[model samples]
Each structure stands twice: as structure tokens, then as C-alpha cells.
Target: MQNTIFITGASTGLGKAAAKLFQSKGWQVIATMRNPEKENELNKLENVVVLPLDVSDSVQIDQIVKNVTNKYSVDVVLNNAGYGLIGALEALTDEQISRQLQTNLMGVIRISKAFTPHFREKRKGLFLNITSTFGLIGFPTCSVYSATKFAVDGFSESLASELAQFGIEVKVIAPGGMQTDFAVRSMEVGSHEAYEKLTAEVSKGYSPEKLANYTKVEDVAKIVYEAATDNKKQLRYVAGSDAIALYDERLKLGAEAQVANIKSMFTF
Candidate 1:
């Protein structure tokens, strides 16, 4: 039987790329998004089914899992539905902060929980989570966003140990910035007069020239494929050149030095 991958946030960006890539490789792709009706491309692909899934909604997650597991034999569940919440803590509203946690952190947890039983019963499956380079390190404007990703990074590590006995594997794909609509569409930036200078500095990193240097969405999707099929005990796969450079520096400089280095990059 051909393998299958259940992906979240399949409407665009990396999720869409992964859906197309996996479908081309002969795997059944269960591409879930908030608005499946709006999707124009992936639905037409062979062996690819686009379903509606709002990961933050627990009831919806349970229903989707029940329906999909009943029909398709999912070999991998890719928890890739998330958005960036960027701002100094004071600049962010409670609603934005809560929503970020709901979608990015709670959403992944709920989806994974819903599929755990199916994977356990099957005796083999992969839980591939898309985190971020910020998950591995801290940043100024990305405080809450980094928190969500970092939580997932730690959650995946613990869940990996818990699920090992059940023949289930949990892996994390931590990619750096990508040249995708995420910056425009999937990111929310809060504003505060007090932090204007700091926000401006952070915004510089997202400029056209800087973003052009980021990794391609398609390339990171390939790493997602590797983590699914590599059959190794690896827990984290850092994708992209920028991500690799930052991660390597972290290793060389150690945690304390890395923090100081990041701090030195910004000024008040």
C-alpha cells in the first residue's frame, strides 16, 4: 500500500508545497485548510483530498481525525498550521496573544492528540511538526511566536519518548525565514509607540532584499519529506542555509554567548 500524509494549513506556503511534493511521490495527501472551498489547485491532484480543518477548534479537529482515519490509512501527520505573532509584549493585545497560542501551540497539540490513537493502533506512524529557527533561539519582536514554537520543540521531544514504545515517531522541522506569503498574509505585527525604534530594527530583517536571501518554501518541504521517510531516530531537522548558520553559531558559541550575540544585534 502507498503511504499517506495528512497536512494542515494546505492552502498556501510550505503546506501547499508539501502537498504537491508528496502527491507527486505517490503518497495520498490529505491536505487540510481552514477554507477548502477556496483552494484552487491541490484538490485536482490525484490521490490528494482537500479537507477543512481549523486546528484551533478541538471539536473540528476530532471530527476531521475521525473521518480521515476511518477512510484513509494515514502514515504521517504533519502539523504545519501556524502563524507568526510579532511585536514587543507591550505592543500586543490580549486577543492576538491568545489567538497565537490557540492556533500555533494548542492547534498542534490538539491535532497530535487526535491522531495518537490511530498511530498507536497501527503500530507505526510519524508526527512531523513544522516549528521555526526561533524555536531554537530567542528573538526580540518574536517573543510570543518564539514561545509557541519553542513549546512545540520541547513538546515534541517529550512526546517522542512517550510515543516510542507505541512504535510512533515524533519529529520537528525547524526552518528559518522563507520567501513566502507568510510575512504578508500569515504574520501579525502589533504596534506601540514606546517600541517604535525596536520594531523598526526588526522590520529591517523582513525587507525585500533580506527576505530574498531566505530559503524557498519548496526546499524546506523536501526536508519534511526526509523526516517522514528517513526512518531514523532523529528528533529535529533544521532546514535552510540561514537556519543552519544560526544553529551552527549557537553550537559554537554556546547558549550564553548566543544570547549576547543576538542582543548585540539590536540597540535601544
Candidate 2:
């Protein structure tokens, strides 16, 4: 039987690419976003249903779960509905911080909780989270965003261990950067004048600006397919060539050296 996958944030970016890729592969896709009206293109695809789901809204999440369960036995749940809130920690407001956590961290928690019962009953499922390379290493001007991703990383790690015996796998994808509207729409900048220098430094490291950056939406989609379809799942998949290379470099450098190198790169 073709597996069914439910993806959050399917309106654009990697989610959009994954939806198209999976649909081409003949899998049933329940592509959800904040607005159903905005999904005309995705809805026109075969075996793809564009549902209304605002991951930050609990009511919407519960309703989508019920609708999905009634219509299909979803085999994989991709928690990809998140945005970046870039700012110095001191300049960030409580509301801004809360919004970041709500959409990135708590949203994942809510979706996972709603689907856990279904996975438990079937005893087979996968939860894939789209994190970032920043989750592994912190950087300036993206501290809050990194914090949320760190939460995702820790959550996926702990949940993977907890759900292993139950046949549920939790995996995280840490992509360095990609050519997507994520940089244009998903990033939140702060009002700290002191952050100007830091912001410039951060901009240089953006995945889109990097030379021959290997993190593409389709590339991440393929990795998502592997995580969903492969019997032996990996805990995390780095989705960018630069990320993989940098990860290796970090590993070789010892902890102290890695920290020093990162600090020098960011001038932090």
C-alpha cells in the first residue's frame, strides 16, 4: 500500500517541494497550511488534499487530525510549520519570543500529541522535524531562532529513544540553507542598533548567499522521502553539502577549537 503523509506548512518552501515530490511518487499527501484558499496549485495535484491548518492554533490542529484520521491512516507526520525569529536576546519582546515558541516548538508538540494516539494504536509511524544547522551550533542575530530549533533537536532525540520500542521513529533534518522564501518571509529581525554588525555577519552566512550551496528544497524533499520510507531510520539528516562539510569540520576541531572558530567567523 502506498503510504500516506501529512505535512504542515505545505503552502511553500521545503514543504511545498516535498508535497510535489511525494505526489509524483504516488503517495497520498494531506498538504496543510494556514489558509485553504491559498492552496489552489497544490490542491489541483492528484492525490493531494490541501487542508486548513494553522499549526499555532490548537483547534485547527485537532480538527485536521480528526479529518485526516477519518479519511486516511497517515503513516508519517512531517512537522514543518515553523518560522525564524532573528534578534538579539535582549531586544526580543516576550510576545515575539512566545510567537516563535508557539509556532516552532509548541506547534510541533501539539501536532505530535494529537497524532500520538493514532500511531500508538497502529504501532507504526514517523515524525520528521525540519530543523537547522544552527540547532547544532549557535550564531549571532539568530539566537532565538536557534533556541527554538535546539528545542526541536532535543525533543526529537528524547522522543526517538522513548518511542523506539513502540515502532515510532522521530527524526530531524538540519539543512544549512536553501533557495526559498524562508529568508524573505520567515526571518524576523530585531530593533537593536548594536545588532547591525551582527546582522551583516549573519547575512553573509545565509544558505542562499553561500557559493554552490547544496541545500535545495528538492534535496530536502528527497531526504524526507528517505526518512519516511526507509525501514532503518536515521536520527538526523543534514540536508546541505556545506552543512555536512562544516559538521565534519566541527567534529574534527575539538570542542574548544570549534567554539573559537565559530566565534571568529561571527566576530561574536
Best by lDDT: 1
Question: Tens-digit lDDT track for model 2 on 48-137?
Answer: 988889899999899879889987999999999999888788888999999999999999999999998899889989999989888887
**TM-score for each of the candidates:** 0.99, 0.94
Q: Report the lDDT of model 1 for residue 97.
A: 96
Question: Each candidate: what lDDT?
Answer: 0.95, 0.86
**Model 1, poorest ten-residue lDDT window?**
259-268
Off by over 4 Å in 2: 207-214
Per-residue lDDT of 28 in model 2: 96
How would you encode candidate 1's per-residue C-alpha lDDT over 1-268 as one tens digit per residue?
8999999999999999999999999999999999999998998999999999999899999999999999988999999999999999999999999999999999999999999999999998999999999999999999999999999999999999999999999999999989998889999999999999999998998998998999999999999999988889999999999999999999999999999978998865
